[model samples]
Target: MSSHRRVWYPYVSPFDPCPPIKAKAYSTPPSLFLGYQPPNLEQFTPMEALKIGTLWKVFYDPWYSPYEVSTEEDQS
Candidate 1:
């Protein structure tokens, strides 16, 4: 299995006006890893498919916000 998210460092110059960013992260689609659909793959229910945005379970990659702030109650 491969990582869904990847990170890379951008070129930073000392002569730049603003502060430089060290590393940046980006997400790739799950379909890129799948070569072809198999005969009988697991599938999500109708209600679940509508909520998840995908009918196939293998293709479901939940989106997580990088800038989302978690409250103290959510930690538990």
Candidate 2:
């Protein structure tokens, strides 16, 4: 299967004072690959749908972040 995630190297200026990020990443939604919605698409469970913010599994495209900081609330 093809991945929705993509990576690229950004142009870093020598004159810039801050350190340059060698690579950056981003993702595209899975829905983009589909031409149209088909009949009887698979679905997630009721609780899973609420948590994932989508009912249909085919339409679910999770956000990918390089920096994810966990707080005390998340640990609990």
Q: Which candidate achieves the best lDDT against the true structure?
A: 2
Off by over 4 Å in 1: 67-76
lDDT of 1 by residue, 1-76 (tens): 5667668899999999999888887778888899888879899999999999999998988655556633422564
Per-residue lDDT of model 2, residues 26-46, tens digit only: 878888998799999999999
What CA RMSD would you report for each candidate?
A: 4.4, 6.3
How many clashes does each candidate structure show, in the order listed? 0, 0
Best by TM-score: 1
The TM-scores, one per candidate, come to: 0.77, 0.74
Error of 2 at 21 (Å): 0.4
